[model samples]
Target: MLPVVLPLPLYAADASNTMVVSAAPAASGLSELDTPAAVSVVSGDDMRQAAPRVNLSENLSSVPGLQIENRQNYAQDLQLSVRGFGSRSTFGVRGIRIYVDGIPATMPDGQGQTSNVDIGSIDHIEVLRGPFSALYGNSSGGVINIDTQTGQQPTTLEAGTWFGSYGSWRNSLKVSGATGDGTHAGDVNYTVSTSRFTTHGYRDHSGAEKNLANAKLGVRLDDASTLTLLFNSVHVKADDPGGLTPDMWRADPHQVASNVSIYNARKTVDQTQAGLHYVRQMGENDDLSVMMYAGIRETTQYQSLPASSQSSAAHPGGVIDLTRHYQGIDTRWTHRDTLFSIPVSFTGGVDYETMMERRKGYLNFSNNGTSTDYGVMGDMRRNERNLMWNLDPYLQTSWQLTNKLSLDAGLRYSSVYFDSNDYYITTGNGDDSGSTSYHRWLPAAALKYAFDDSWNAYLSAGRGFETPTINELAYRSGGVSGLNINLKPATSDTIELGTKKRIGNGLISAAVFQTDTQNEIVTDTSSNGRSTYKNAGQTRRRGLELGLDQQFAYDWRLKAAWTLLDARYRTNACGTANCDGNRIPGIARSMAYAGLEYAPEQGWYGGAEIRYMSDIAANDANSVKAPAYSITSLNTGYKWLLSNWTLDMFGRVDNLFDRNYIGSVIVNESNSRYYEPAPGRNYSVGLTVTYAFQ
Candidate 1:
C-alpha cells in the first residue's frame, strides 16, 4: 500500500546520490524537480544487476505505462508498447520514437527495431510518456532515448557471460578509458564493446544467433566544444516459429505450426550505422548542437504463407528481400534569457531524414520440370523501389512564470513523403506504382506548480499523430500488390493530470490520462499471412499509471509499478462484428509488478519479484482471449572485490510456480492462429570479471 513515485529519478544506496535524465525537447537540461513530464529513467547499473543484459524486457519492467512481452521468437523482436499506441505491431516498433546516443534509431516512416542496441554498454534508458512526447515529431506516442556509457578515469576491461535453459548463452567484452577530464582540448576518451548471443529457443524450430559491436570516440576540440563519433553494427539470424491455434497451444505450448518447418520460416538481418555529434557552448546564454548519421540495412525473410498463395500475379511472394539505405541530420539552437522579468529558455530545431529501399519478393517453393522443392527461394514474383522522407521543424520553450508556476510548450510541423516504383509488372499485375504525402501540426503544453520542495503537480495536453508504416502500406484489399496509398494517418488529442512526491525515503509518481482519436488505423483484412489496414472511425483510451521506489532498512529496496488502461473502439463502422465497442486486442486492461531487493555492491545479495497481467483479447472479434496470469521470480548473487580484479556471479529462477499461461498474442491473425504460449520454470546463471587499470 505504498504511495507511487514518478519515474524521474532513482536515488542511490544513499539519498545524496541523485540521477536525473533529459527525455524530451522542452524538458532537457532540467532535473527531476524542474521537469513537467512523466519521464522514466533506468540506470544501466541497475538494469544489469545480477541479470542477463540481453533484452530490453529485463529491467524495464519497473517502468509504468509501458509493456514489453517476450514472444520467444527473436525474429519478431519484443512486443513493446507505450500506453496502447504500439500494441498493433506484429514485427517491429511503431508509434514511438527511439534514439541512441543522440542519433535516431527510428526511420522517417515511423518503423523501427531494437536489434541493433547493445545492452552491455548502455549508460541509461529514458522513456517519455503522454502529451509531451508529441514534440519528438512523427510517430510520437512516446519516446525512448538510450545513451551508452562514457569513458572515465580508472579505465577498466571486463568480460561477461551467461548460460541458461534451452541452450541459451551470451558472451561480451568491453574496454573503456579516458585521457583526461574529457572537457579540455586534446582530451580523448573512448569505449568499445562487442557481444555474441545464441539460443535454442523454448519452442520447436526456434533458434537464433546474434552479434553486435559498438564504439564511441569522443574528443574535446576546445574548452567550449566537443566532437563525438559513434558506430554500431548488428547481425541476426533466427527461426520464425509462427503462431498456433488455441487447441494447438493448449495441447503443447512448445509446438510450432506445421507450416513453419515445411517452409523453413526464418529471417536474417545485417545492419551497420555510424554517426557524428557536435556540441558547442556558444557564449554564456546560447548553445549549439548538430547530429548527422547514415546507415544501411538488409533483411531476408522466409514466411509460412502457402506456396499456392503466390500463384496469382497480384500476390507478393512468400519470400521477402529488402535493402535499405538511410540517412538523417538534425541541428538546433538554444537561447536562455529573461522575458518580462521571468527566466525562460527557447530552442528551435529542424530534422530531415530519408530512406531509399529496394524490395523483391520470391516464392518459397521451387518447381523444376520433374519435382517441386519446398523451403527454397524461387523466381522473383514482385519487385519495387521505394523511397520515404520526412522534414520537421519544431520550437520549444520553458518559462518560470513565478515562484510556484512554470510552463513548457512546443509545436512541430511534420511533413512526410512516400513514393514507389513497380518493376515486376506482369500480365494481370500491370503497374502498381504510387506516391503520397501527409502533413500534420502537433502542439503540446504543460503547466506545473510546486506544493513544496518535496512535491509537485502538473497538467498537460497535446496533439499527436501516427502515420502508416512502410509494411502497413505494402498491401491493399483484394490481394492487391500495390502500396495502400489510401491509408490515412491517425491523429489524437490527449490530456493528463499527474503528481510527484518525495517522501521520507520513498518516491512516488502517478498520473491519469485520456486520449480521443479520429480516423484510427485498424486492420481491414488479413489472409494468407498478409494484412491490410484502413481508417476505423474513432477510439478512446483512459488510463492510470503509478510507480513507487523506496529504500528501506539495511540495503533493502522496494519497487512497484501498476497500470490500468481502458482502451476501446468508438467507431460504429469498424466493419467487424465486435469492433464497435470491444477492448483493443493485444492490450491488457491491467498490469502490476512489485519487487523486493537486498542489493549491495559487495558481499551477497538477493531479490524476489511478482508480476500480474489481466486477460487480453486476442482478436478484433473478441472471440478468443489470453487468460490473466501471475508469476514470480527469484535471484541471488555474490560479488568479490580483490584488489584490481572484481568478480560477480548470479543465478535466477523464473516462473517459480511453473504456471501455464499465454505469453503474447498475434492480433487479428487469420486462421484463428493467435496464441503464443509461455514457458515454465526457466533458470539462468551468469558471471562477470573486471580488471581496473590505474
Candidate 2:
C-alpha cells in the first residue's frame, strides 16, 4: 500500500476529463475511465509540489499496486516493482517498460534506468498495470509513460534554487517560447531546461553530483500533420557507501561499511539521447504515427574486490568500463469507423530496437608490486562486445458491443536476439562467446461494462514472457566461465478483475489479480560476491489493490492507497526440494499509505503523508528478513503573483519523528550486507520565479 499527500490545485490542463493518448507501448487512445486495464495518472504539478522534485520515488507513493523504494544510494537507482513482479532485480529496472516522450528508456535487453528523467519539466506520468501490459512484448510486467511539458501560447522564462539537508543544493533554469501564430506550417514551440545538483549524502563516504539538460520542440507542418523532437542528457558521479550488516547498522546507521573508503567504490555515467515523433491524419477515420530515437551511454565503475581475486584467470576484474549505443523506431496506423451502426477502432504497429556495447574490465590496483590505488584503472583483464536486438509487431482493436459494454483485444509477436564475443581469453579462460534468441506470441483481451453513470467494471486476461537480461547472463555460478547459456525465458498467464465508482465528490477503485508462471526464474547460488540464476518449476502471485480520492470541501482533499500481495515459489528447485512454498525474496505482504491536504484556491497550501510497509524476505530461503516500518512527512508552499511575474516558495520535512529503519535491501546479496539505511529527519527549502513575455 502507498499513500500520497498533495494539494488539489487546478494546475492540470484538463482537470475535468482524463484523456490518455499513447498510454501503452502501442499507443492505446482511450480515456482513463474507459480503459479496461488498471491505469493511473499523476499530475506533474502535484508531484513537483508534493516533495523535493528530485526522484520518482518521491511522488509514486500514491499509486496503487506499485512499489518504489529509495536506497539513498544514487549509484544503485531506485528499487521499483509493479505488484510483486519486478522485485528480483539487483540493478536497474527489470520486468517493466519505461518511456519518455515516445522514446524507450528501457533497453532491448530488458534493462532500464530512470536517472536521465527530467522531473522538473514533466507534464504528467501514466502507469499501467495488469494483463494488457503483456502486449508490449518481453518483460512487460507493467508500463510507465512520462510526457514532458510543452510550450504554451505565452512564452515564459523561469529560474529556481533549492537547498536541502545533507549538504544538498540545486539550481535550474528554463526557457519556453513559440514562434508565429497558432496556424499550420507557422506555429513552432519549444521548451528547454538545464539543472545541476550536488549532495554530500547522509552516510560517510557517500556523495553524488549530477547535471542535466532537456529540450522539446514541436512544429505543426500542416492542419493534419505534426512533428516533435525531444533531446535529453545526463552526467552523474556518485560514491557507493555499500550495504551494512545487522551489527554494523545497529552500531551506527549512518556509518559506511568496512572497506568502503579503502576500496573507493564509485561510479560515473554520461548519456545523451534524442528522439523525433511524427503524426499525420490521413482521413476523417484514419491516422498514422511514427517515432525514431537514438542514444549513447558511457559508464565506469570501481568495485571492492581482493587482489587475490584479480590474479585469478577466472575473475572478471573489479574496474568496469562500458560504452553502449542504442537506437529504435516504431510506426503505427489507427482506423476508426462504424460496423452495423456500432462503433469500432483498430490499431496496428511495428517496433524494432537494437543495442551494442563494448564492455571491458581492469584491475583496480596499480599492480606495482605492493602499490595500490583502489579506484584507479590498472591492467586490463577482461574484454567483451555484446549486441542485442528485438522486433515486435502488434494489432489491437476495440468494439462497442452495446450501449454499456465494450470489448478490447490485442495480439503481438516478439522476437529477441543476443550475441556476445569475448576477446580477452587467456590460459585458463575459454572462449565465452555465445548467441541466443527467444520468440513468443502474446495475446490479451478485456471486457468492460458500465453498470451506470457512476459505476464500471472490467475483466482482463493475457500471457507474459520474460527473458534474462544481459547482466544476468554475464556470470555463471560456481565460478564457471562463459555466458549462462542454459538460462531460459520465463512465461506466465495472468488475469485481473477491477471496478471503479464515483461517489459524491470522490472516486474509489479496487482490483484483484493473479498470475501463474512456468519455468520461473530464481537465484541459483551466491559465491564470492557473484550471483547466478536457475529455473524453478513453478510460481504463483496474487494481489489486491485499493485506491481512493475525495474532495471534502473547498479547501480539503484526501487521497489513499492500500495493497496486499502474496508471491511464492510453488515447486522445489535451486538444488533443494524444500525450496517449494517459499515466499519471494523482495516484496512485502501488506502496505498502506494515506494523505490529506488543504488548498483554498490560492494563498498558502499544506499537506502531510504517512506510509507503512510490512516485513520482507531477504532471500529465497526466507531465513533473513527486513522489518516493517512507517514514516511521516509534511510540506507547505505559497504562490503569489506580482505584475507579470509569479513567485513560489516551499519547504518540507521528511521522517518527522526521526525513525531509524532500513529503507531498502539488496535481495540475495552474497555477503549478508543487505540493509540500506534511510535518512532521518531531512529538510528542504526551495523558491521559484517565473516571468511571461509576448
lDDT agreement with native, every candidate: 0.84, 0.82
Give the lDDT of residue 251 in candidate 2: 92
Q: Candidate 1: misplaced stretches above 4 Å?
A: 1-31, 480-482, 573-578
RMSD of 2: 4.7
RMSD of each candidate relative to the true structure: 4.4, 4.7
What tens-digit string does per-residue lDDT give for candidate 2 at 91-170?
Answer: 67888888888788889878888899888888778888988888888888888878888787689999998999999988
TM-score of structure candidate 2: 0.95
Question: Candidate 1, overall lDDT?
Answer: 0.84
Cα lDDT, model 2, residue 642: 81
